[model samples]
Target: MFRSVLVANRGEIACRIFRTARRMGLRTIAVYSEADANALHVREADEAVLIGPAPARESYLDQARVLTAAKATGAEAIHPGYGFLSENAEFAEAVMAAGLTWIGAPPASIRAMGLKDAAKSLMVEAGVPVTPGYMGKDQSPERLKAEADAIGYPVLIKAVAGGGGKGMRRVDEASAFLDALASCQREAASSFGDDRVLIEKYILSPRHIEVQVFGDAHGEVVHLFERDCSLQRRHQKVIEEAPAPGMDEATRQAVTAAAVRAARAVNYVGAGTIEFIADGTEGLRADRIWFMEMNTRLQVEHPVTEMITGQDLVEWQLRVAAGEPLPLKQDQLSIAGWAMEARLYAEDPANGFLPSIGRLDHFVLPDDIRVDTGVEAGGEVSQFYDPMIAKLIVHEETREAAAQALADACADIEVWPVRTNAGFLVRCLEHQRFAAGDVDTGLIGAEEAALTDARPSDAVIQDASDLLWRSRNVDPNDVWDAEYGAPGFRLNAARVTRQTFFVDGVRHQAPYENNHPVVRYGPQIDGGFVVFHGGDAYAVSRHAPRGAGGGGASDGSLRAPMPGKIVAAPARSGDAVTKGQPIVVLEAMKMEHALVAPFDGVVGEIGVSVGDQVAADAVLAVVASTS
Candidate 1:
């Protein structure tokens, strides 16, 4: 089944594992970096290499340049498509010591679920329940605060080595448990150099719910069910779903038989997942679920479990890495509908969601759901990686019609020179406690100002300026064009260029009439045009820019959004700051950024110094306002 596979990973999950290894006829090989050389999964691979430069530890976590570009493109097998070096257990024992075919799972099951304190002690000896707290290995801080005061006052200091919420920490009592365990041991010793920690039990309304296990190499295992992912933010996962909204039927068959007994107690194979943490205060039961960690590979919401198990988990991870086995066990897996996904992320849900790099002018995403994307319409979303940029997904037959068709396909998705959340994921699918599904992980920090309110609507800015003035062909009875109303006057004075735009929170201005079809803007902008008027409807559409060598306006320099370090700055040089104060904090991907004061300021230039590595907007402090 595997003629050539080599996808080691790049964007849109290396074009989503080369579209299931070219629909099973295999032959893929991608590997880029140099900020994904003109990306789009390196122009949809068949072969492509250059595996280095542009960070990600010198190129997608190097590992001998992805085993010499998978044996110089002979490939055979190797599809780690979920975050670089997919659960690297020494790069899956260096692709099974270079003989190829390591299509995932088994580097001793990614080193027995690669360290979340030894996979919660192997999911409590595979009875698979976990999450009680203190998986013990004593890192003495008064015995981890007497085991978080005998597992009571709101615990949770994770990070027994890398997982998104980077070295997590919660501690809601006993005076914030020794400064959140010294800031979760300095962010788990600067992100998984392993500062070792484990104290759980802070499940106060958690939801996550993962499952979707699969296996083969003949030991067989199956479950392909569950995937709620509780729409999180800091604990990563931006949105996901599939058979989970109030799941019943005997707790979804005891959480899919304890996620196929935690993937047959890690003899697991191909497409993994597990991750539980359920108990939403008291809802999805199977004795209130637990075990929170076991991704191993393939799950950046694997297309909402492949749109509710219609199956194609990377062509069943290349038909179980070419030795096929369990094709339909676990009673032929069936869920059939309701799927969702979201995760668009160029980042800027009103700036706290940070991470937004540049150039992607009018990338237009959403042609009826299922996006996936690796950046197009001219790419460059760089900041060295993981700004996500696409995922969308959707499928219906329920779950409130797949959350109202992913909120009308994210209000008709459209990205322009970088700026999206697609209107903050259409206000988190019209929020109201996420349309009353009562999700958690602080549901976007509890409706974060109505989901980063960028506020758009004077009828959606007169329909984004009458769809940008009928895409610039604005002919209002063409009297020599300009919308046909110009030449007015006895005193030769017809001024109208009063711009002041700000939609959603409303504040518009468009006083254009200096001449014909030049009327500021308005007419239910749904497909394009958006003439300005100060109230902010500039939309316009079809620009297609990408790295912007010419299209300007985003390089003034203000970097650092995820990937931390640089705690506290109070910008000095002429200090006058105002527009949203707090001047410099950064500290990358593990979250904590401030670098504010964008307007009404005075600190003209500071260019990062407190241990600077800055990327996302790279120019630390350069205010200069009084325009």
Candidate 2:
């Protein structure tokens, strides 16, 4: 094995690779951007290097800086964990050419599987079933439209180089195909620098099932069972589990066999995943599953695979990179128990799942089970990268038990100020259809309202007064605290010491009394305490809106929800606007959030001009009600 290894990625995946590298007695080097100077991965590395500034392109994706860092730290190998340059075939070749072991798929294999169109063609040649679609060189809109029409309605327009739900669109009718195709192509070009797209027959009930295939230098490959990534939001995976809920032995064998074939077709080595899209209208069947694309690096949800198989996949990667034989034969692996993982992100589901960035003042996660993260309390979730905070994973003998246990764990999360989708995850886990093995990609969108309900219950809000009262009157050092109705003690509320506060800018009041424990909240900060309950943060403050509010109020004001640059201001001060009409585009965290009109009104103000930088709550534009 290589003496030292440098991880050319950031966040949880980088930290995860380091854990295994340390266990294998290898020196670990980490590269960080300016924003990630205090990041957990940098702090935990044996040696760290400053690659560039906060932006990813200047740091994580900077090939020259990464190579220089590795050479300086005497790192014998480079591990591109996932994302960023993980799938960049040229980067892989550069690492190899620089005489460093690239602990990932070879450049040849990466190139072979880089484009979805090419990969599908290879899969077909390898006798692996592929989705019925068009993957031709014709870039004309007419050809794409013709392909869509032939494939029937509800065709999937996918960018050849897309991942993480980007550059993808589903058209349910012929009329929308052209528009969807145009949008998909534009995103693909902007995101991957490749506008080429392929059309596929959209599955009515699609379930993402992928097999973990590891190949060794000895030309041997083995499968580590399969994972069901059907539970998704906006094409991004929300929850993933091992031993797909409805998978039978026959289907597993067929899928795993095809996965091995897919890997072997490209002479693939190291850790790779063969993603298959299954039509789960009925239970999983071999005939219903087809190859989608291949992920040529370790996956974020690899923990669940480890929990079930009792194998260290990172170690496998290290050995393979060192030109070792397969760790175990195909027959040696067996699925043990059900494992489920939920990606906990710093985002507000109710508000279009926009990224939430701020200091994690009171971030706390459950101790039991497995929790993987690269951020901690007191750390700032900067608007320079992805906002995934952690991954909550659980393993149980039964799938039912795993889902419930993971749901409870999600409910136990306590974060303040910065909002999250923890409550949404809980609902997803406990959803009747989800619990019954009726999983699909449309589950989140179909049940978005119930899942993303951000409102705190009447009882929870009623108990907020108790939290505020304790924050003011109760002493932390007092061991002899009053219990419910114990010697002049009162439960819920004894005296109506009315306390007024605005939660998310809306005002509410409740009687002050001791309602211990049910309503948990962080200590007083920025005017008032933030109620942390059921994995949701309700910003409660005694003060009301000051002047022209910006932090996204129900008013017709369009504000920079977070610190960002104004990209476009389409609506003028005198322009008439309707509710939800796009007025301003605020760019932050590598995402563009459209600040839309809150209600039907006339545009009364345009606060920020294009190319202007603004603060978290800075007003961008405003649309006043006609009344």
In TM-score terms, which candidate is top? 2
Candidates' lDDT values, in order?
A: 0.73, 0.86
**Per-candidate RMSD vs. true structure?**
22.9, 4.4
Query: Of the candidates shown, which would achieve the greatest lDDT relative to the real structure?
Result: 2
Please provide, for model 1 over 1-627, each residue's C-alpha lDDT reduced to its tens digit, 9 standing for 90 to 100. Answer: 758888877888888878877876777888888867888888799789998887777877888988888887788788788866788788788788778888878888888887887887877888878777786788978899898999898888887776877778788797768766766676667655677788887887898888888888888888888888787876888788887888888998888888888888878888888888887887888988877888878888878887887888888777887787867876777888889888888776775667767787556666866888888887778765667778888889888888888877776665654666766777787787777788978778767887776655444444444444344565433334533233212245643323344443234554333233322443333433444321122444433223435311133235555454675575677888777676776665445555667567577677666666754434576676666
Model 2 lDDT vs. the true structure?
0.86
Model 2 lDDT per residue over 256-347, tens place = 99999999999989999999999888779899999999999889999999999999999999999999998899889898999999999999
What is model 1's C-alpha RMSD? 22.9
Cα misplacement distance, residue 498 of candidate 2 (Å):
5.5
